[model samples]
Target: MEIVTGMKKITFGVFLLLLLSSFKLEASNYTFGVRIVGKGKPMILIPGLKGSADTYNDVVAHYKDHYTCYVITLAGFAGQPASAELNHPLKGQRDEIIRYIIEKRLHKPVLVGFSFGGTLAIWIASTRPDLIGALIELDGVPFDAGIEKNHVNMDSIRRDARFRNEKIIDAQADYWQHVDSVRHTKKFREQGFLDMKELVTDTTRINQILDWDDLSDYKASRLMVNEMNSLDLRDSVSKISSPILVLGSWKGWVNFKTKETVAARYQKQYSPADKVTIVFSENGKHFLMYDDFNWMIGEMDKFLKSI
Candidate 1:
């Protein structure tokens, strides 16, 4: 019966190997806070800064029947735990996403990102073009307007990034204080602490925002902004080969004045692309997907089908 015992041991070893593989998969998914739903071709959605995977509920609902949606909320955002090892969280996020795609054996799935997440998506597409089939950027550009206007050299960029990194601790403290005030004090709410115009009218959206506002990790947000403000993606845009769809906002918020100006800026910035499509939303704010849902959905559907 020695031969029978040998076979049993081999089978047990195979079972152990499979168990370890399953644990690794679960750990990776948990670390990235990825929530997958639906079944079909893979579709990855990355939410904006301080935003959660819940932000893409509407989009997932629309495409769930046809696509398996992978909604990612980066670590330390939207109440998720922060990673102590990640000094440059956005870069970490990009690397983790690439790893996830590889581990899951996704076949160049469509990647859709909003705001800061869109910036990450752009970086991923540029750096790892083979990992994605198509890309959709919702109100995200390749270069920082401030850095571009000042014509800052690489040394200055490094200096500015360092300065920002040094100030992160104070910024985090101040942000947490503000968050606490908004959460606890009615006076702070009356002082117009939060901008309501940016939020959609839907109850579900409002509730999601409320939940996010309550639990957002300020430290992660600061790290993301520090990296984002210092990034210059002008050189990387030309490296991307996949189909790109940029949904730009016409209603400018801080510095931008008019729709024509905003449109012109994007036209100039993304003009280097050989396979890029730019769509300007007349009424869309920074959150174009929520602000102009029907139009955005239509465009996304058409783009997905085309790609």
Candidate 2:
């Protein structure tokens, strides 16, 4: 009887191992750096410009036990080799994400995006609402008509593209020099561009940021931004039917007289959405996740639970 019981226990252990191996195999098929961790409901995390799958390390750590996180590192960013097929990165990224979700059989997975990633998330949810269950935008907004309102002419597009190309060249040349200067300095932290204080204090996060900075494809980044500058998505936002939670930053630098003005701006910007909830992080900067982590986690948890 003891020998029979031991054999049964060994068989169960082998079955568990095979199940875990199958899950890993399924996740490995994605071309993008899709790091799947933890367990339970599916959650997709898209990082900001020049960010990698690990960009949401803190957030993933917090929710790993409760959710299976699909952290994606886009082509040409986060040290991943640029895909030649991605001629138009913005649209290409959206399509790739949709394909990934379908291929993986992820049902109603919550989408979380930060910065440029958040903007892409909005595009995905607007265009393919069926693929996502809900969305959380962290310091990202739809296109503003004001940027291209005056530059509708072809000449303006040509000029802007040329200018951006030159800027990209300059950025590539000085990228490492800038990285070295900011790697251990306090000057960058003082500028408040990305809540650098939080970055500098966290060595792992700081190193990850710098690593991506060193390997980033500046030309691709600039090209995507230049193309995006010519498009507006106000109408697209109106078409989205999925529930959305937008957490915007209200730092006083963007010609805002008060926090109320900033809040009003975001509310008006996202008003077209039928089901949207907007919140502002008064004390946080662009990297709100790092600046107000506890608040972000609490809000995200609440939003996820509700959905």
Candidate 3:
């Protein structure tokens, strides 16, 4: 998935205020936190990297009347506490989500994940296919990007991931401040803004996203992504038995691939699954929720009702 980052005032400041205030955080023992709202059928919303529980404010606002929503904010993002004890934070997140479901008696809750959260949801569903209800992902999958795809040696990948993660953790203080320094630049900064423009149309949401990235526990978040990106889950998706709806964004890759090609790529990656529906946004970038809310939510609503 493409990532947009950094800060700029942008347009409509109050809208940003409204979204931030929607979630009331209650930290948990599971290296994550929850902001519960509404009542009835359970729904768990997971945000992307650097995302807070409030990232699902729009979805929560719409669904709170009918569904009991569990908006999750994982550690290392949105100023949530990051755990140092967990060897695998992504798995730590996945396992705890399963435990949270069992402990809370949220039987068959719908799982909605964005970006990295979507990747985690895939991990969660694949691990315990019987746990969650239906699965919905917004521009996220068990995709292994960044590292070369041709490398067949899994051990080498694991070692590389570990080294990169360790380097970040060692400098946990300044990891994200620069990627640290690697991504922190004037042109890079402009590109980040450009990314924001491409990914989301709502300026307030853009501002909110930058704050999330700014306050994010860069090392902790990178550790999780580093580990996640090392494993290719294209085939592993077959293990998930639940029905899935994936809304993908393809506008960013227009320079490199056609819409048909990008859509086909998403289909090919998710082809291992038995019951999966993949849809792409016509003009949206990565943040489909903010960029193409109407079309995105329409597809989501249809899927939710179908199951």
Candidate 4:
């Protein structure tokens, strides 16, 4: 009886150690705070503004067994110290990601972005085409629409900028809450419904916005503005040598009636059978990744497999 009890204790200790080891392995495996899984064609996934890399678990799980998946969380978004500032803008964030890929030596990975993330992916492809193998945009403006043209009005843009700035200071306000309010989190396994109030309390969100301040948006907005002001892709749709797939919500751009319309109208700019393929989902909204993830995943699968 004594021998049997000792053996049982030994087994239990081994089980505990194994469980701890497994947890450590999983945590340590995700180097660079980027969660990577599966095995096949390498694919890099970029999340929307203030989004988490972990949100892609469902989508990544579906394809990880067949494709290597890399989910990136922008520096400030994931509790990392903000090396940049509020006025730094989106271009800084994009360049940071571009440098990360180059430094990591990820070869020709399929570049996928959601919302603002889509904008980043497009910028990378446009600027660093050789680094990207295939481009997949989910519910975002595909090309750079000159900032002036895209904004409702200079007054509105400045007002919005001010509002955003104030929210950055509070960090616990619902600045980004409305973004996820319409999203479907049931399928996405999010931490919660992303209540605007709750979002203000979120440490990750607070730190990112506070650290980056207006820099991320300012830079991105201007880079896009310059692209529109000087180098317009309107005529060079055919020049985008990289394989591209664009996705949008079902209501098209009519639902927003204002700000979001620019996003929808841009789709028509591209020909259906052209190098770029535009797909619409009846159930998705600005946060299409959460609204209709299955549909998005299906399209991603089809696109990745084809190219």
lDDT, candidate 2, 184-213, per-residue tens: 466544344355443334445555576685
- Model 4: per-residue Cα lDDT over 1-307, one tens digit each: 1223444644666767778999787544322247778998788898766566765767787888877898887654544333343543455666766776787688888888876677667767777877888888876554444422544343555566556554554553354454334332353224333432132434464444333332233233333333222333344444456889888763434335443554446665554314687777766555555556788888887887798
In model 2, the runs with Cα more than 4 Å from the true position are 1-31, 144-208, 252-257
Candidate with top TM-score is 1
Q: Who is ahead in TM-score, 1 or 2? A: 1
Off by over 4 Å in 3: 1-27, 146-156, 171-191
Whole-model lDDT values for every prediction:
0.78, 0.73, 0.80, 0.60
Better structure of 2 and 3 per TM-score: 3
User: Clashes per prediction?
Assistant: 0, 0, 1, 14
RMSD of candidates 1 onward, in order: 5.1, 6.3, 10.9, 10.5
Window of ten residues with lowest summed lDDT in model 1: 1-10
- What TM-score should be assigned to candidate 1? 0.83
Candidate 1 lDDT over 19-75, as tens digits, reads: 899987787554568889999999999998778998898899999999999999887
Error of 1 at 59 (Å): 0.6
Candidate achieving higher TM-score, 3 or 4 = 3
